[model samples]
Target: MIRARAIIDRDALAHNLSRVRALAPHSRVYAAVKADGYGHGAVTVAGALAAADGFAVSSLDEALQLRWAGIDKPVAMLSQQLDATVCEQAGEYGLEPVVFHETQIEALERYVGPALKIWVKLDSGMHRLGFAPDRVDAIVTRLAALERIEINGWLTHLACADDPSRPETQAQLDVFAQVTAGRPGLRSIANSAGVLGWPAAHADVVRPGIMLYGSSPMSDRDASSYDLKPAMHLSAPLIARNPIAAGETIGYGATWRTPEAMDIGVIGIGYGDGYPRHAPSGTPVLIDGVRVPLVGRVSMDMITVDLRNAPNAKVGDRATLWGGGLDPDEVARHADTIAYELFCRLTPRVRFEVI
Candidate 1:
């Protein structure tokens, strides 16, 4: 069997969902299972989080996949609905489409079918999607005239909820509140960061993504602070161990050199398996349950780790890349990235086992 594998912990997923509920007891959860549950496998995650009020995905196909997997919960497509055909399909599948532009509303207007539940997205502050807040009233009026669709609610993405200190989060929330106040449908503005940091944004519905996978949404705090357990445990085997003399260089570009005679262990995973290539030397990996420093440039299929901290480490010893005791957020920090990218960018070469 391939030693490189990711273990998906269903219990941790459920626990994280419970944490979201604990934070916003009055709000409904639309769990984001997009990007294949951030590479944990969407169907598997949906099964574990079946109790979520709804599942949110990036496309109609993803929502359909969950439905085919026996997930009966409401599935909302967070991305825009591009055409009338997609709008019709969404109605057929009972999937909710997020209308972010005038084109989407027109598409829905043209569709002829049973009423479709739709969430109108407002460009609160992100400016990446959704209509401008000023245009929301006009959009809602047009939407209200559409007889074939039901306005489920209004939703917005937070630009900086991860850092509560940033004034933009509250600014966005204020705009969202002002724009949707007295609206007939539910109003949702919180993502995982909002659920953790900005309680004021926890409106009628909360969409929690990265935090549900046990990663900290905050830049200053760790996941443990929120009692979030990592749902994916990535590990590989040490395929080779070599003794290197002092001043000897290792890996491509000779990015690292030993200051003294030391044992170097080669792990059977790398960027090819979605490990970050930019992860610098001194990044942590776990061998025999002991933390060790990565010693050389991360290669296509391997990474070299200094075994000085774990001399008993031998070939075939298990090395945890992240998860378990080591968090993906820590690894991502060393790579100058976020845990969301680390989890979502995992390559298909890494086998996954649901636990």
Candidate 2:
């Protein structure tokens, strides 16, 4: 048996996608499966999200992985592939590359043979990728001139769509609308946060990433508010139950001390299994559906949890790190990180089982 496992709920995955459809009924969805579907396994996520109009990935390798898995749906490469050889491979594999830089455009021009599907990225505000707003018109013109390359869509990323109070999202949307005004192609701008908060930015396609996995994109809201179910339930078994006296310190560095005599259940999971090492004392773990407080520094493969509330919890009892009753968002808050990082950082030592 695996010491730790990430239980992937396929029904929850599908439910989250359905929630996206309900929110953005008019927009086609490009499910973001990058970072191995945020470490939930890209191929598994793709199969669960079969209704998505397309899949967006970070590289050509990820796009081809879906193809190798027998997924024939359109795969959009969100990052630039400036290498001529990689661009040629993208074309052959029918992968759509997001063209942002002149170097990428040059590579595509040199290697594209019959026809290449492409999404032209515009730098509305994020300033991470995509062409500048002022240069998009000329860039579009140049890309259109290539007969073998088709500009399938114009897309931009939102930086602050998660915060509704921020005005930058609207400003970015305005610039995107202005730049792609008369363009005769699909327009996309919404990520998970954009799809939920900025309806005006939802054009022809809305690419959702975190929301499809059931975590809320907004800081103020939660997944339950959007009717999305948590997909990944991470759990580990209790391998040791030890009696500790008051003032006894547990784990490395003696960071946590027992307030009273209590049973410390050592769970067979820790940073090595992708549990956050930064998770502080008092972070909650679920034992038999009851919340228990973590009492010590997380070790490489074990964490000591105070099992005062659950006296029956013993060796072999499963302790939930997140998901099910305990939300990953809540755990993420304790770790001073986002749910995306928590999901994506799981090591290969952790087993993933789809249910």
The number of the candidate with the highest lDDT is 1
lDDT of 1: 0.91
Q: What Cα-based lDDT does every candidate model obtain?
A: 0.91, 0.90
What C-alpha lDDT, on a 0 to 100 scale, does residue 35 get in candidate 1? Answer: 94
The worst-scoring run of ten residues by lDDT in candidate 1 lies at: 80-89
What ranges in model 2 sit over 4 Å off? none
Runs off by more than 4 Å, candidate 1? none
Candidate 2 lDDT at 40 equals: 95
- On residues 78-135, what C-alpha lDDT tens digit does candidate 1 reach at each position? 9855697787778788889988988887787788988899998999889999999779
Compared to the true structure, candidate 1 yields what TM-score?
0.98
For model 2, residues 1-355, the per-residue Cα lDDT tens digits are 4689999998999999998888899999999999999999999999999999999999988988999999998899998566877777777778889988888988876875557888999999999998998887688778878888899999999999999999999999999999888888999999999999989978889999999998998978998888888899999999999999999989899888888998899999999989999899989999967999888888899999998999888789889999978989999999999999999999999988999
Question: Could you tell me how far off, in angstroms, the CA of residue 17 lies in candidate 1 after the best superposition?
Answer: 0.6
